[model samples]
Structure formats: C-alpha cells, structure tokens
Target chain A: MEWFGANSFNFEFVSSVLQINNIQKSYGSVRALNGVSLQVPEGSVYGILGPNGSGKTTLLGILMSVLRAQHGSFDWFDGRYGDGYRKKIGCLLETPNFYQYLSGEENLRITVSISERGDEADIERVLKLVGLYERRKHRFATYSLGMKQRLAIGAALLGNPGVLVLDEPTNGLDPVGIAEIRDLIRSLRQAGHTIVIASHLLDEVEKVCTHVAILKKGNVLTDGPVTDVLMDEDVVELDATDREGLRSFLLTQSLTLETDKETGWIRLRFPKGQAKLEELNRTCMQQGIALTHLSLRRKKLETRFFELTND
Target chain B: MKIAPLLYTEWLKVRRYWAFWGIFALVLIAYPGISYLFYTGYQDIRSSNNKMDAMLKLMVGSPFGFPEVWHTLAYIASFLVFIPGVLVIMLITNEYQYRTQRQNILDGWKRDEFLWAKFWVVAALSILLTIVYALVVLVTGFVNPDMALAGIEVKSYYIGLFALITFNQLTIAFLFGFLLKRALLALGFFLFYFLIPENILIQLSRWRWHTGNWYHYLPMEASDRLIPPPPYLGEITNPADYKQMLQAIPEHILISVAYTGLFWLFCFWWLRRRDLT
Candidate 1:
C-alpha cells in the first residue's frame, strides 16, 4: 500500500503510467489498432475488454515499446522512454519468456540485475506475493504452465516497479488460479500501484477494474468508468424444460429477450424494479412445466464488452 | 545509469551461459594441444626436406617467407581464426537468440549502452587472448631446449592486442549482427568473406571508400605486421630497429586507435538510424 509518485492529473502519479493518443497500427493490410486514445488514471486498476483479435495485445505492445505505431504517440508517464524508466514499469505484455535453463529465483535474479531498482529482497517478496515462494528454486522448464506464468509475473515484479501492466494475466488458469491472481492483483493495487490488465475475460475485468476500455478490430469501441460504460440494465436468466413456453410467457408479461442463441437455456432481460419472482414461479408451476432454474443477472461488463466489440 | 550492477550481471550471464563456458574452456586448454599437434605435423614434413623454411612455416604458417616476430604473431592469431569474431557476434546475438535482449533493453539499457558494454567486454577478451598467445610464445623461447626455438620474441603480441580490441574488427561484426539480427549468420558471412578481396575493401571503408580497389590498407596485409614472416620477404625488421621507417609513417598504435574510433562512430550512427526489429 505505497504509492511512488503523487504527481498531478496532467502529470501521471500511477506507479504505472501509459498515455496513448489516436494511435494507429497496421500489419500489412490488416489494421490492428485505429485511432485509439486513452489515459490510464493514477493509482487505479484499469482493464481492456475485447474479443479475439480485438487489438488488446497490440496496444499493450505499443505501450511497452516492443512494437511501433504508424500514427500517434505515447509517454510512459512523465518519462517517455526516460532513463531507467523501464525499471518503474513492470509489464507482462504477453507470457514472459524466461530462461528455461534457470530456476525461478535465478531468472528473477537475472531480471533484477538488469533493472535499475533491483534489490535482492525483491526477488523473495515477489515470489511470496504470487504464492510461488516455495517454488522459487525450481527450474522454470520443470514448472507447470500456471507456475511458469506466476514466475513470469514474479520477473516483472523484480526491482519493485511502480506500475504493473499485464496482458491476459490470468490466461489459462483454473478457477483457483484465477482467484489467486485476482487476489494478487487486488493486493498490488492496494499497495498503490496502478495496474492495467487487458483480457477477454470480462467478468474478471468487471470484478477488478475501476476503469474499462472496449476494443474491436482496430478501433476503440468505447472506454470509460467500468460502471458507466457497462451499465445497460439489470437482467434475469430463466431456465426451464420448455424454454419456448417460458420465453412466450415472459414476452407476454412485458420482458424483453435479447439474442436468440440458445446455449441450452433461455435468457431474458427485465428492466430494473420489475421482477416479481414468486408470482412468476407460481404462474410457471401452473403452466405444468418444471422451472429448472432462475437467477438474477447483474448488468455485466461482459454484455457491454460484447456489445461494444461485436462489430 | 547504474553501470556497475549491469556490468556484473552481464559478466554473470556470460559466465553461466553454457556456450560461453564451453568456448572459454576450449580456448584455455585446447590451444596448446592444437598448436603442438600442428608443429608435430610440420616437423614430419621438415624431416623429409631438412629445410629451415619448412620449420619456419610450421612456426608461422605462411608463404611470404619473412622472419620478423610481428609476422609470426599474426600467424598465431590466425590460428584461432574466427573465434574472436564469433565471440563478439555471440555477445549480442546470444541475447537475441535467447530472447533476453528485450528484457535487457527495457531494463534501463539503451541499445547503444548495451552495445557499449559488450564492446568493452569483447575488447577485454581480445586483449586477454592476444596477451596469452604472446606469452605462450615467450614461454616457448625461455623453456625450449632446442637452439632453433631460441630466437622467438614476443613484441607483436601487444600490437595484435590493440588491433583485436579496437572497434575496427568488432564494429563490423556487431554491425552485421545488428542488421541481420542473427548472430551465427553474420559471423559466418564475416568468416566466409573475411579473406575475400573487395569485401575487405568495403568493410575498411564502411562502404565509404572513394578510392579504387582500396584493399591496400586491409587487415590481411597490415595484419602481416604482426609476426615472423615467410622466407621470401627480404629481411626481418623489428619496430625498434626500423627507427627511420617508424618515424616516417603514422605510428601503428595511433592508426589502429583511429580506425577503431571511426568505425565505432559509424556503428553508432547506423545503429541509431536503423529499426532494431
């Protein structure tokens, strides 16, 4: 819970900082990102939501200076490629490529050596934070994919950087691993580091991000506060043996059904202050059909994410 | 900004990387064995003819029959062949091959800064290797019981040391590595075309030569200044002995340093302008 820089709004105070403006990028004829502009606020968790091939990684790569942009520019807060600036930005633009021959500790040590802010204790602290302290001495080549990913995170954490920018940080994780990473990211944010995570997992982003940006193709679909950007309407999902019967009943009862894709259930979006669940259940029972399930679905970041990035 | 720790880390990288250690072991232990085997083969040929030039050729490995210590030293360096060139290539290319360059470049190291450190390390290794070769020659003279080996001297060792370290050789090597973005290929190209005529001229000028067939001042001929020469060269002349000649042209040290300096400037400019990707 320690913030490094307390600079102004015009000045970035996020231990991590990225400022991009109308950035455009293309690979051959494929436009990867187009006219995307965003400023990640200081000391908050920011998330990018998009579908596959939605330019999330492309944006992160540009911020890391790993890839160049055809148009627009960026500054890694105050210091744009400043001296020793990388030491302040702990970024996992993608899965890290650690030395396969080296142990987690050894790999961390090597990165720490290269970092301007390197301290020996940081190696152990980051290991502990990511819940891989016990496996610190294990060779990276022998680690499980999740453990390798954790080790990669530990590498970025070396030298105790101010901000953490992770692209798909919870990629390929089981529920437990996902929860653990979520907790770890939350803890990092509490420690006063600004974090920007780009992920296709909208639920994960919704649970953690204070701000959100949605991207589609090579364009910024929309970006803003998580609540404001995603808040469409509260919804309720209805599941039963005869979804057509339930859908007809709900439509007659004044509820709106969105898409027609049936993934083994029927879902309806009811406006706020409109669900009389007990009465609906009574009616369904009277209709001689067993109600398999009913659950109130919050206006999810995922729906907005899909809506913004669908095209 | 903080160079000490970075240098230590790079040192550890080379120390721990298997290729570096493997090569280091070969250089230290195999050189003497290889040299002895070479001489043994030469002595067999010499026995058949009873010719002194055969023995000298065995010692110096040359067709230009000169007897100076400097020419002999050049012969000794050539035995290592592309090792020095390859070592410089490995310095950056290994990092690229391993995908460690991005991390290193992002770890507060500018491209030029990283190259500069590698430059220093390569220079130091070159100096060390040259000195060791020179010392081996000195030791041979002091310890050899044969009267024929008593004339070996060790001055050109230091001269070759300067040439090897100077950016003259490494700049081109590193330049090619940076441009190709592959170490082995660049080093291979350098080694394959190393002795070719026009290629040396182009490298000598950094493709900047206006003079025609500018191969005269190349390392191939100038490198001849390093050791005892083949028998056909008229006479062996020590730098100290040729006081008048020494006074006439620019000093060997100054020219070597100037060439290195100019090459580095070109390297820096080109590196800055090119897209490193």
Candidate 2:
C-alpha cells in the first residue's frame, strides 16, 4: 500500500487498472484462450508474452471488445465507468487498421471524432510524439511499415487516454524501427500511462515491461514482476579437466542445484548472486576435479521464456 | 458522445474518398443528362410537326411542373439509385476491409452509434440528391414554356417523397453491405436483386401464383410504385387516366415505410448479434 500510494503518479488511486478473470476464447475447434486470468496494476507496464498462435492477440482483441469471448469476463478501472470506459483506454489491435486512402492527419481526425472528445488539438500533438508530424499529410497507403505503426500509435494516443493497449506494435519492423518503438513505449510509461503490450519479442518484454505473463497453448504458465518471473536466477557453465568426473561431482555438490551436461560443458543453475566461482573451484578441488573452463552467465527472459513455455 | 462529432468522423472518412466523389459526380451528371435528353427528344418531335398534339407537348415541356416532375425526376432518380447504392456498399465495406470497424468499437463508439453514423451519411446523401433534383426542376421550369414557378405546386411534397424513396433503396444496399461485408459481392447481389431477381419474382408471382397486381405491393415493387410511369396514354392526358395512375400513392407510401422499418430492425439485430471480427 505504501509503495502503491507513494510511487503511483497517476491521478487514479485504484490499484488495479484492469482485472481479467478466467478469460476463455475459441475459434471453432481451435482454442485461442483457455481460462486465462491476470491483473494490471495502475502505472505498470504489463507485457503479455507468448509464441505465435498463443492467446496473446486473442486476449487483446477481447479486451478491445472486437472479439467475443465464449467464457469469463474482465473489468476496467474497477467498473467505475460503463461502456464509455473504452474512451479512457486507447488500443492498437493486431495491425495498423486505418483507411488507406486517408492522410495520416485525416485518420487521426476520424479517430478523434469517434472518441467525441470534441477537438483535434491532440491530433498534432500525438503525431509529433510518434515522429509522424512531418508526414501527417501523406496517405496511409504511402507510408512504410514503421510509419504506419507509428501513425497507429498516434491515433491510439488521441484524447490522452490513460491506458494504452498495443498488440505487436513493433511487429514486421527493422532493427531501427523496433528500437524506436521500444524507446517510445518506455517514454510513454515514464509519462505515467499504464501500457499493456502483447508481444512475442522476449527482448522487448525484458527491456520495457515491469510485469509479464508467459502464455503457451492458451494457458498462462506464470505471471509476476519481471524480476521475480524472468530474471530471478542465473546460469553457470563450468567444465573440468575430466568432464565425466565433473558431471558426477556436480550431482553430489549442494551448491550445484540443477545440472545439465553437454558434450563440451556442464551447465549448472543457481539462484542469482548466490553462486561464486572461487567457491565452486574449492568444491572442484576437494572433489579431486581440476577446473578447466568456468564462466558465469545471467539468465535472460528468453531463457526463462523457453523454460516456462516448453511444455 | 454527441452525434455531430460522429458525423464529422464519418465525413472525414468519405470526404476524400475518390470513389464516392466519382459516383456523386456520375449521379449528378446522369440525372440532369437524362432529363435534358427527354427535353431535346420532345423538342425534335414538336419541330418535326406543326402540331405534335398540344397535350403531349405540354406534358413534355412542363417536365419540371407538378405531376410530370414527379414522374420524370423519380424515374431518372431510380435509374441512378445504383450509384448511391454502390457508394453505401463501399463505405460500409471499406470499414470491414480495413478492419477499422474494430478500431471504431475500441475508440468508444457503441455498435449502434456506428450504425447511426452510416444512417446520418445516408440522410445527408438524400438531402443533397433532393436539392439537385430541385435545381433540375427549377432549370426545367425556367426553360419550358408551359412551366412557371407557380405551376410547380405540390412539387415540394413529391421531392420529400422522392428523398424517402431514395433512402428506402439505400437501406436495401445498407442491409446487404452490413451482412456481406464485401463491397464487390454485396454490389453484385444488390444489382442482381434489383435488375433481375425482383423482376423474376414479380413475373413468377403473376404466372405461377396467379397473384395479379398484388405483386406490386412487394418491397422493391412498392417503392417502384411510388414513381409510376408518367400519366401520358400515348398522346392523351385524360383526367381519368391521370387519376388511375395517382390513386396508389398512399398505398405505396405505407408499404415503403413498413419496409424501411423492417430493414432498420433487421440491421439493428444483425449488428448487435454479430461480432466485429
């Protein structure tokens, strides 16, 4: 409560901006989401991470009210508002969905008009924010993939929405485009907006997300803060002069928790900051094993993602 | 949200739509062009003979006046009804093609508001066409020797009725567009329904069911009845012939209203039931 009260910068005092309970969706025989549930706290950058064909996009579609879920429900802002609650939440679902013949400025005008916020002042502001202000007059069909995605983000930013829901905002972009979008997302979060992103990019999730949920085959395997869920552990790769002897020796040591041996190196997993190279060397010396190659590696979200969703 | 802003959004989408503008220009040209053709053909007939029947000449010359304006403008308008029909189909289908309909729902528009925005567009279209029709009538009045401003009495009511008739035709297109979600397919079926299927049904009703005259009360036929052929029996404009033609106005109006209401109900039900995806 103290952290939520003091650190929370947004005006809303509510802890959970979104509460999704047991959301289930299916496309005919293929189940898109199976009993998925998660909560997004206020002022948190929430990332829904999964592989392709997982329930990430389906869940985002349902939250945007574009697709109907067969089961379960979700409430936004604690049900403080009715259907109009969508006005406070902006969304860019799936791809950049805009009228191709319309100019970027015109498309934003249309979005602002639909929002009924009664002004186009934010249109220019958002265009500038997305770095599309100079090309605001260009037709959407003429834009590159990066520009199209940026225009979509600008449209989503209209009316200064409190919650921004972006589904694969950086998909199909080059390295530079991806980096720009990542920076933009981080900047938006820094400005105190709750951002919910659904992505297959684990590196992006690690870089921008404060909290994350890993999904596979329509089921959420785990969800929590980034530190607890993904970056909580470290991996160690150590090899001895006698490889077979070191494998047997690692299985007997208390410091070595989970051990896997490849042809070249024996990999050991331990809690972050707990394992020391000198301590492992002492153990190797006592076991009559001479250490040849020893290297410490930090586990990335990619490694944890593979671990959780492998099943 | 106020409807004004929604309408503005709708306008923003269509104002720059080239196809919509192209169709609008086509309708504007086609209606007046058809009217002028009739006028020139009438003039040629009169010039070929010293006396080409006084009443026939009067009917042709006063094409903008009451009774004749209703027939001429309404028939001309129906010939171009497909223009607006295609426009509505494209407008509705473009949303589906681009998947902006999903974006719309996400942006806080109720599904009903989205539907209403299209209806508002229809309303604006009807008024614009009606004004053009009125302008054509005015030009016809200024040129024709038999038609003066005073002779065009009861013209405003028929113009309103013509606008309603056009809206009724557009509603058919709207229902098909919403249900089909593809412009080409909806337009194909729309043209097929109006150009061939309705005629087949009317003919089949007469031959197979022996439902003579009653087939005229069918939805499309009833709207067609609103604009019957001009009351000119070859070279005669007998009062009894005119009365017989104008007698079904009330019936056609009632049937059109009922059909429009039915189409609206179906549209509402379908929009509410179908997922945006």
Candidate 3:
C-alpha cells in the first residue's frame, strides 16, 4: 500500500497480468493442471514447454474460459474478463478451422466480420500482415502449412488483441517458417503485447521466450525468467578411456560425474560461480589421461527439465 | 451496431447450406400457392348456412385483436412449421456437425453467446417466414379481391406466439442436432419422421392407446401448426364441442408459446451442463 506505483519482486512490475492460482482439474480420476499457479507479466513472451498430453492445451483452454477451472481462479488485469474478457484475447489453439470452401480473403472476411472488430480494412490489414496478400484469393485448403500457420496468426491478430495465445504456432513449419514466426513473435513482443506460447520446440522457445514454464505429466515443475533458469547450472563434459579413473579422481576431489554407458561419455557438474573447468582439464592432461572431448555447459532448459522430471 | 456483427455471423452461417435457401423458398412459396389452390376448392366445402358461414367464414375487417385473426394466422402458417424447423436444425445443428461451435468458442464466443447467436438466427427466420406469409397473402389479395384478410390477432400475442413457434422449432432442431453431429444423419432422421412413420403414427394415435395425445409434444406437433386444419378435421372432433371449439380462433397459440419457452429453457440447461470436448 505504501508503494502504490512501485514495482516489487512478487508484486513485481509483472506480478501477473494474467494469474492462475492453485488451479486443479480432475477428470474423474485424472488430474490435469495439478496445483498449477502461473503469472504472465504484461508485454512479455512466455513459453510453456511440455510433452504431448502434458496439459498445455488444457491450460490454454481454461485460460480462454473454454474449459472452466473446476477448483481455481484466473484473473486478467489488463481487461474485463469477468464476463466479456474473451473479446480482448486472441488465440490460435489448434489447426485452422476456416471454411475450406471459401477463399482465404473470403474466409478472413467472414472471421473478421464475425469477430466484430473493424470493417473490410481489418481484413486487408491482416492479409498484409501474414504476407499472404497475393494468395489471399486462394482457398485455405490449397495453402501450405506455413501459409496456414501464418493465416492462423493473422486471424489471431485480426482484432489486434493485447494478448495472443498460440499452441504450437509453428509445429509443422520448416526452418524458414520457424524463423519467420520467431521474427513475428519478436515484433509482437516489441509492440508491447503479451504473447504466451505453448510449444514442444525447445530451440524455438529458447530463441523467443523471455519467461518459461515446464510441465511434465500435468504438473508445472518450474517457471521463471528464461535467463535465470538457463544461467543457474554450471556443468562440463569429458570423453576419456579412463572414465572410471576420472570418476574416481573427481569423487576424491568432491566433483560430481554421471556416465553414459551407451556413448561412453561422462558429464561433470560443479558448484555455481566456480569456473575451474580449465584447471580440471589441465589436471587431466598433466596426468596422462587421454581426453577425447572436453567442453563446459550452461544450465540449459533441457538439462533442468530432465533434472526436475526424470525421476 | 454490435448486433450487426452477431447478425453478420448468423448470415454467414446460414448462407453456406442449400437447405436454408431451398426450404426457405419452399415455405415462402408453398403457403400462398396452396392458398391459391384452395381458392379453386371454394365451392366444394363452402358453408351453406349464412349465419354459420358468417361466423366461421373468417371475418375480413373485424377490429385488429379479434379471435378471427389468430384462427386465420393459425390456418395459414400451419403448414409452414416444417420449413422453419428444418432451418432451426440447420442453424443450430450445423455448428455441432462441423465443429464450428467449438471453433467458435475458441474464436472468443462464450457458450452463452453461441446459444444467443443461434437464438438470433431463429428469431431472424421467424421474421422472414412472417414476411413471406404477408407477401403471399398480399399477392393473393391482388389475384382475388374477395379473399379474407382478417388481421393478425393480438399484435403482442402474435409476437409472443411468433417467438414461441420459432423457439419450439429451433429447439427440436437443436435437441436432435445436439445429440448427433452429422448433418446427413440429422436430415435423414428429419426426413424419415416427416414421411410414412410420423404420418402413420398420427393416424394410429386416434385408434391406438390414449397416449396418442402426446403427439402434440413431438417435433411434428409444432410443425402441424403450419398446415391448416384439414377439411375432414371434424371427423376426429368430438361432436359435442365442435361448434364451441371452432370458435376459439386462438387455438394452438398457447401450445406454440409453451413449447418455445420450454425448448429455450431446456437448451440453456443442456448447454451449461454438457461437456464441449
């Protein structure tokens, strides 16, 4: 109360533009969103990474209020979602469901018309936005995967919403498509719109997401700034014939090593802010150890995900 | 202005199906066409008793809210229910059939808006059907100046009855459509019911068990209002109350209202509770 305009850490500037508090959904015996709590800060690119059937879609569905939260609450601070909040949010959740018989322009017209946004001008604006103005006259069925995905994005952008929620916005795209969508996400983020994406594509998330949440088996294992999660771990790797000798030496020296029998590769983890990887490499070489491969690793999301969920 | 978007969406949904246009044309033309044909049958059952005919022949200019108006509207629009019923099915059931409803939900419409958008479609149809009835009647007046033009009974009552008929037809369409997501299946069952089985059942209701009265509760019951009382309707009427019953010009009006209200109420209940996955 004392600092009404001040932004703190919890009540931080992005405390939560959109907050889901302790949501729990159970289908008879199957729990979906198990005690899930998340805060989507305003004007941030947030990614939710999970495997198939990991409850990403369910979470988005609940956010759009398509599926009601059986045991929790979702609050949106930027708009009036209490009754008419859906109007403010745009989404591209699944495969495009346009009238396949109609041309892209006609379909866009119908969608925008029904959307109750601007008039014919909005349709032209979206077609131009997706870079599909030339193919706007083609039927949606004839468009390629990239075009369809772009059109879906264009549809989500039809009303120029403050938040755009996309599920695998580039699931089937090639490198070019991925790059284009990444650029689009960047532009969207730059425009100060909140963008939340649920994707299985790690590199895509790594490139575009400012914050991320990981889910495995319907549980939100971890969520925070991407930089913080990625920068937390200090690890290194080595491939040596005397792996056993190296493990024994590392154990004696209070270092942790995990070996992969299939690849015969050994990974070593050390405490944070301690950069003694060069010293360790020097010791291995000086001891006449045949070091095949040597490298240091940051705490990547993949590592953190496996660390948290592998058990 | 906002309603335009809602109405625009309704138009987009309806324009895709040939059934909407085809059946609408059929209803718009069928009533007046049949009425003109009935003009040829004027002498066959023309009442001989001047007083009875004067009372029952349909007064043309008795003040607006007369019993005569409802009787005429009931007679004229009786055979028209089937068209609107099919339209209702097209309007509501198509969403479920094509997964458009779910997509619509994702496109930012709530379950209530979905329901409300559909209700607007039915309301729009009712207005169209009424205008067609008026047009046909108006054209018939040009062809035969002597034709009766008893005004619609109770403007407010007619409006309510209009709402009732629209709601009832859409609900029947909705109930069957909600259960089956296939357009062909919805259409096929609708055709089958309207054909031999339903007609035979109507006949059997009189000779079979007393439960035949429940026919009025079936989808056919509301549609039956579209067709005028058959010339031989008196054969099934009770001899004791025939005269008194025929005087009640507003027959079937209450049933239309009751049926529409119940359907709208039930649809909302089902929509709220059902899983949309």
Which candidate number has the best DockQ? Answer: 2
lDDT of 3 by residue, B21-85 (tens): 88878877776676666644542334456765465446333211233334344455655566667
In terms of lDDT, the poorest run of 10 residues in model 3 chain B is B59-68
Distance (Å) between predicted and true CA of A163, model 2?
Answer: 0.9
| Chain A (candidate 2) TM-score to true chain A | 0.80
**What TM-score does chain B get in every candidate?**
0.68, 0.90, 0.69
State chain A's TM-score for model 3. Answer: 0.76
Collision count for each candidate, in order: 20, 0, 8
- Model 3, residue B108: what's the lDDT? 64
Docking class of 1: acceptable
User: Which regions in candidate 2 have their CA more than 4 angstroms from the true location?
Assistant: A1-11, A116-121, A231-298, B55-67, B148-150, B207-209, B233-245
lDDT of 2 by residue, B81-180 (tens): 8788888899999999999987899888888888888888887887888788778876776677656556566545678678878888888888889889
Given candidate 3, what's the lDDT at residue B222? 47
Per-residue lDDT for B39 in model 2?
Answer: 72
Interface alpha-carbon RMSD, every candidate: 2.5, 1.1, 2.3
Q: What DockQ would you assign to candidate 1?
A: 0.32
| Overall lDDT per candidate, in order of appearance | 0.65, 0.80, 0.67
lDDT tens digits by residue: candidate 1, A218-287:
7877777876676555466667888778778767867667643655665666555576677778888888
